[model samples]
Target chain A: MTAHPDMHETESSVREFSVSPERLRLTPEAIERRIGYGDESAPDNVRAAIEEMLAVFDSADPFRCGFRILDPGQVAFHPDRIVCGKVIFRTGSIIGRGLKGCSALALLAASAGPDLSERGRVLISEGRELAGYVLDTIASECVEQCLEHLESELAAATASWGWRLSNRYSPGYCGWDVVEQAKFFSLLHENFCGITVRSSGLMVPLKSASALVGLGENAERKDYECSLCDREDCIIRNDG
Target chain B: MKETSSILQSIAQCIERGKVNRASPYPPDLRDRDGADELVRRAIDLGIDPQEILTDGLMTGMKVVGEEFRAKRIFVPEVLMAAKAMTAGMEHLRPFFASSQATHRGVMILGTVLGDLHDIGKRLVGMMVEGAGWEVIDLGTDVAPEDFVAAVERRPESVVGLSALLTTTMMNMKETVARLKEAHPETKIIIGGAPVTVAFAHEIGADAYAPDPPGAVDFLNSTVAEI
Candidate 1:
């Protein structure tokens, strides 16, 4: 994708976006789907639990999202590696194939902050496992919704410049090694969006997500093809 | 005096229906009815056999839950509720087991392997195993292999359950299992997670692999039967 002449930028740019809990809504159906409740509605007690958690969420502000956009000239895609700016990401073949033909990469991170995660942990420790589990599910859903909102906004902005945004692929999912999360994080400012990767490669706050999206004329935003990936335990595949 | 059989049956019913206490408003169908909490306390006051309460009441109800979960007739929420009700009943029985007046079916040590901070699945297994009348010592998440070795050393007879959510962390799970086995070859280790499979379990030399909490419970129960 060629950058608009008027939009010429010589270096990577970082953008921070804050999303309110209300702005990122989750439906009962979405919860049911995430819990793998296929072809059946959640039980009444489960619905009651969800309603209670939603009430808590309604008053909570836990989402913070930010991304560093690498200029096309500084991005390179190999058969199994992604070079963004000065960093090399061994993202494996699946991500390589996904990002192929793209001119730019957006390394984005979204988190459900720390409060909600702490609350969920406290609930579980207090023997309220169902409520804690429900809260965790809601947080995951919210983070994804935040990412979707960011993606939609970027698509609109890039579409005006005749560029397409590909589907975002995370480090831990598909064939991408999660250890590359360190390299991915290196491209962003310290604690961007208040997210941090542990030595084990687990993102702190636990309810956070990081991914890379390709932007180019050939970049396609297609439905996630679970079949193309070998990770049968992926939440998206299980949720779908 | 209430017929003991009827009370035990009621306790099982309360557990299966997820009626925790009289005040619990869950499972609307059982609202305002005596639940597992009251039923279990009443059973204990009446001098019902604690083992019988565990085997015939809590375990029986949880057995149905396990089968339902396996068949996909119920999901995690239902299982969670059932486990909660079972917990309420188990509280009344805890004193007996603690005093050796009653016995657990077995013991199991559970944790999310090192590098994996995910604990929801591990906690679910702990609840299920405890509900099925086994003593569960949950080591929590991000547990190193040495921790597993130490825990197993303390409770050599206990079955060990290792969990991991990420593929990268699953490697840590393999390492944890290997270390535990090398230290205590007699220890039976069961592994589970999203990425875990029967083949992977075999490859890792684990005694078993369960895809869900109920599967873990069933596997533990089968091991007890084997013993």
Candidate 2:
């Protein structure tokens, strides 16, 4: 198989993409962690279930991401809103603080595809609630993995310009209204990576994610976002 | 030792390890051995009280699973398998339970509030609560406030649980809570989901907020005790 296909062609449309699943691999521990297992050893049955679901994931071509680097001239940040090209975002304190210093921005959207979500629903209909839950959790992690891979690609690309990529910030994080998901989708091409933003700002496939990453020389990086938020019982905080 | 007690203990072990039946190939060590189904049947044949089989056998195993889940010693897949094993045993006792031979700890009405299609959290809590000895009435996802009211009208003493995974649909949960409170002010309402918070629960006037399935089980048990 080709290491990374430059684009994915589908019956409905074609995706002109940069990051692909060629470098993406799902680890059992990562999926287990997303499903609420920390460092604890998974039981025999749970491990078997993880293996079973992993086989399904391996067989299905369920991952894709699309991104574009836009010039700073096309993006403007106001006190309450951000205008990137034709798309506008209602900004919050966290987003303003994160995007403080940047020369350009990278708008990215990623999905683990609809097949995984469909499989999860099928499991639920079959009364396999556990299997369904596991699938959902794994799908969530897969999108994050896609984001991580995108970041790596962005980081390398930005380094060539003596710039760094800021942490990926999504609409729902840090007081940003989730309604901006529509705005994010508007900036991207139609059905980009098969992720559709619902009217309510929720994404289809239920496991897709969209975010903005600031690119500049002064962009800061953190080990985790726990310190910036007030979620006291966050598993990431507990892990630390 | 009474033969029934021994059989009940074995059944409880089978449920804890997620051994469904003699034909199950899981938990390789127990493959080709009597599982929860066979032991439950043998206990029934030995005249073990169905209620005792439920509380001492199925519920006992589930309690351990719940505690382990709380401690993060196990995750969803393991608890689900345990639920499956418990279901295998419960299937044999369903008729007896329906005939009023088995007593439930309490009645809980569970659903994913309207406009929310997410049911994974609701189902986990339902299975966990049922395993903890409650009779759970699961109203599948996209349940409206009127549906909750009608279910509450049928069982006025039942506690209600609402779940929503979206910031958008979480507003619907608030509406369902408000409607249920207006119709049955005394009914306890517990809310949970990915976007739900303790502050949000208080804002929505929910009686309690459960962060996980075990937390929900604990909340339900405590609420039942209060009543």
Number of the predicted model whose lDDT against the real structure is largest: 1
Poorest 10 consecutive residues of model 1 chain A by lDDT? A1-10
Q: Indicate which candidate wins on TM-score.
A: 1
TM-score of model 1's chain A: 0.91
Q: DockQ of each candidate's interface versus the true one?
A: 0.62, 0.45
Number of clashing pairs, model 1? Answer: 0
lDDT of 1: 0.84
Real interface contacts reproduced by model 2, as a fraction: 0.46
Write the residue-wise lDDT of candidate 1 on B45-139 in tens digits: 99999999999989889888878877878878888888889989988888898899889989999999988889878877887788788999999
> Candidate 2: which stretches are off by over 4 Å?
A1-15, A18-23, A36-40, A77-91, A127-130, A235-239
Model 1: residues with Cα > 4 Å off, grouped in runs: A1-12, A231-235, A238-240
- What share of the reference contacts survives in each candidate? 0.67, 0.46
Please state the CAPRI-style docking class of candidate 1: medium
lDDT of 2 by residue, A95-208 (tens): 777777776777778888888888989997897766677777778888888887777777765575677887888877666777778888887778888888766677886778
Model 1 C-alpha lDDT per residue in residues A168-189, reported as the tens digit of each score: 8988777787878888888888
